[model samples]
Target: MSDTSERNQAVQIPQEAFDWYDAYAHGGMDRRTFMRKLGTLVAVGYSMSVLTSALLPNYALAEQVSFNDEDIIARYEVFDSPAGYGKGKGYLVKPATGAGRYPAVLVIHENRGLNPYVKDVARRLAKAGFLAFAPDALFPVGGYPGNDDEGRALQRELDKSKVQNDFVAAAKHLKSHALGNGKLGAVGFCFGGYMVNYLAAVDSDLLAAGVPFYGTPAPKALRNNIKAPLLVQLGELDERVNKTWPEYEQDLQANHVEYHMFMYQGAHHGFHNDSTSRFDKASAELAWQRTLAFFTKKLA
Candidate 1:
C-alpha cells in the first residue's frame, strides 16, 4: 500500500478499455462497445469522474474533428449596410465549424458582378479560417449579369466612386464585426482585381494584404500610395491587359512596395474561375496557394 503504488493502481485502465474508448471516439467502434468498455472501467475501480470528463462534449474535441462530412453545409448570409446606399449590404459565408475572431478577407467580384464563383471563393476563404465578406460592388448601380457578349457592357456601367465607397464601407464593417480579428486583406478577380488594387491605394491603412488577379493596372499616380503587401496574378496570353503589366511591375519596384507578380504560361483571362472551361486548374491552384500563404504570413 505505498503511495506511489496506490496512485498507479487508481490511474490504470485495462488495455482493452483504452482501445475500445479511443476507437469509439474516433469512429472505429460502436457506441455499445464503448459503453461496455466504460462499464468495465468502473468495475475495475476507475472513478466515474474520470469517465465523465473523457466523454463530455468539449470544444477542443471539435477542433480535432474532420470537416469531411459531405452532408454538412455552410452559406453566405447578407446583413445590413448604412442607410441611403441601396446596395451597401455585405454577405458572410460562415464555415460549418465556425471560428471566433477569425481574420477577415474582402472579395471583390469582377465587372460582370457578384456570381456563384465569387460566393464559392468566399466560402473557400472561410474554410481556410477567414471571415470572408464579398459585398456587391455593382449593387449601387444596376446589378450586372455575367455574360461573355455583355462583358464590355457591364464594364461600362460600373460607377467607380460608388464602388470605392462600398469597398471602404465593407472594410470598416469587417474590421468592426464581432467575429473579425481586425486584420484584413482583399482578393479580386478581373475588374474586381482592379478594385482590389484601388482599395490598396485608398484604404491601405486597413488592409494587411492584397491579391489582384488580372486586374487592370492602376494609374501611375496612385502606385506610391499602395502600402499593403500585394500579390498580382496575370495571364501572359491575355491580350486585353498584358501590355501594361510590365509597367505595373516597374511601379511596384520603384515604390519599394512588397509584391509578387506571377504570369501564368499560356493562360488567358478568367483562368481562375472554375465555372469556365477557360479555367487553368494548375495555375489557379498555384495562385490560390500563393494567395493563401501571403495572407497567412501578413494577416495571421
Candidate 2:
C-alpha cells in the first residue's frame, strides 16, 4: 500500500471516543457563553492538528508508526566523559524500518530523570525520521530520584559540573552513531531545558537547533555564542520559572539570534508531560507541533 493509504488506515479514531469529549465539554461549562468559547477553542485545535498532519509528511508518517520497548534498535550504553562524570549512560532509539542515514536528535530529560516520558519523546523523534539519543543525566548521581519528594532530595546531591560533562558526552555519542545523519538537534524539558541552552551556547557546531521547554536561560555573555536556532516555550502561569522568561527573551533578541518564543497563557511547568496533573492538553499539543516544525525547518 501507498504511504497515504497506510496512514489513512492507521489514523482512524472510533466514534465512541468523541462521547467522552462531548460529555466533558457539557459538564465543564454550564454557561452557554463559556461553552461557546470553549467550543471555538476546541474547533481551532482540531483544525490545526488535521491541517498539520495533512501538510507534513513526517507528521503523517509519525501517525502510522508505533513503538514498543522490545523494538529498540540500539541498546543503552555507558561512556566515560572527560568532564569527570564517569560512566554516564544513554539510551538510543533508532528507526525500525529505515536503512539510510537519518537526522539525529538529543533528548534531555526533566529533573525527574530519564523516565518513560523521555523515552516516548525519543521514540517519537525516531518515528518522525530522526535517530534519538536520550542520555541518563542522573546516572553519575546514582540514578534519578523516584518522585517529587525523592527527586528534590537527589537534586541536592547532584554535581552540576558532572551533568554538563554527561551532556557533552551524550551529544558526541549521538553524533558518532552509525545511523546518525551528523545533523543534530537538542530538546529538553525543565532542568534539561537549561542543559540544552548551555550546550547550544558552548557547542554550537554540535547542534543545528535547540528547543527548550520552560528552561532556565543562559547567561547574557553566553548568548553571543549560541549558533543554533532556538525555539523556547514558556508557561505563563508556571509557578517556578515564568517570572524571569520575559527578560531572558529580551536577551535573545539583543544577541540578534534566530529564535521563536511562545508563552502558553495558563500552562504550568510540566504541561508537556501527560502524566502530570499540570498537563495542559491544548498548550502541550500546540507546543509539540511547533517543536516538530522548528526541527524540520532547522535540522532537516
Candidate 3:
C-alpha cells in the first residue's frame, strides 16, 4: 500500500469526534446531528467515509474468542423472566471440558442490546473457565436487528424498569443454573456497566462480584446497599461518566464496600471495545487482566 493509503488507514480520529460519537451512541444526540457534526472534520483533511467508519463499531474485527472454539461450548438458551420480559433469551457459553460446576457470570450489554461484541465477551469469559450468560434485553422487542442504530432505537422503546428486572432475573438465573457453582458475578460496559452497579446494589446476596467499565453509577440511595465487591474501570477522557465518580467512591467507602477503581490515562469511554477506533489497547489489556484476577479471587 502507498504510504498515503496506509496513513489514511491509520488515521487518528480526534478526541472531540469520539465525544460526538459517544453522545450519539448513548441517545444524547441523533444520528443526523452526529453525522453532520462529524462532517466538519472534512475541513481538517479527514474523509467523511473514513471518519464514519472509524466511529461506528465494526463487530467483524472485535472477536477475541470464537463461538465454535473447541475449549468452550456456546449456544443460545431461553430462561424464564415472567416478572420482567415474560421470557428472556441469551447466549450461554461454558468450558467444554469441565465436569465440575464453574463460577457463573452474567454479561450485560450496552443500550444497543446483546450485540455480537457482547456475545464475544461471554465467549471470552467461558474460555477463561467461567460459565457466562449474556441476556438480550431487546428480545422482547424482537432482538438486536443486526444493526446497532436500530438496536438502540428498540432498546429505547422498552420500559427502563422492566429492562432492569430482566437483567436482575438473568443474574438469578445464571446463579442457580445447574452448571454454575452457586457463585455469581457480572461484567458490563457503558450501559451494561451501569447495570453491573445496579445489580451489585440491588441483589447483594445474588452477585458475588462485578466489573463495570465506564458505566454510570447507581443512584446514591442505592449505593450504600451494595455489598458485592466491584472492580470499576473508567477512562480519563470521559468527562460525562467520570464526573459522577467522586460521589460514588465516597458512597462505596462510607459503606465499606470492597472495591478498586482504575482510571486509564488518555483513554476515552468505550476504550475496552475493540470494534471501534476509540479502543485503547494498553488500557483494555490491563483492565481485562485485572478483571480476570478479581473474578478469580472473589468467585473462588
RMSD in order of candidates: 20.0, 11.3, 2.0
Task: Give residue 47's lDDT in candidate 3 (0 to 100).
Answer: 75
Task: Give the Cα error of residue 10 in candidate 3, in Å.
Answer: 5.9
Question: What digit string (tens of lDDT, one per residue) describes model 1 on residues 204-285?
Answer: 5878899999887666787788888999999766655677787888888888889989999966666687553345679989
Find the candidate with the highest lDDT and give its number: 3
Candidate 1 regions exceeding 4 Å error are 1-87, 141-155
TM-score of 3: 0.96
- The lDDT of each candidate is 0.68, 0.69, 0.89
**1-300 per-residue lDDT for model 2 (tens digits):** 444443343233322222223222224323354445445544744332332222222322222224564444655777778774767788777877778478888999876467667767887777776788888777776665554335434554678777787798888877777787778889998788988888888776878899999888776677778878899988875544666677777877777778888999866666676543345679989998999888888776
- Candidate numbers sorted by lDDT from highest down: 3, 2, 1
Per-residue error for 272 in candidate 1, Å, reads 0.4
Per-prediction TM-score, please? 0.69, 0.73, 0.96
Q: After TM-score superposition, what is the CA distance of residue 272 in candidate 2 from its true location, in Å?
A: 0.3
lDDT of candidate 3 over 47-161, digit per residue (tens): 7766766678879879999878999998888988877978899999999987758999999999998988999999999999999999999999889999899999999999998
Runs in model 2 lying further than 4 Å from the true structure: 1-74, 145-148
Q: Which 10-residue window of candidate 2 scores lowest in summed lDDT? A: 52-61
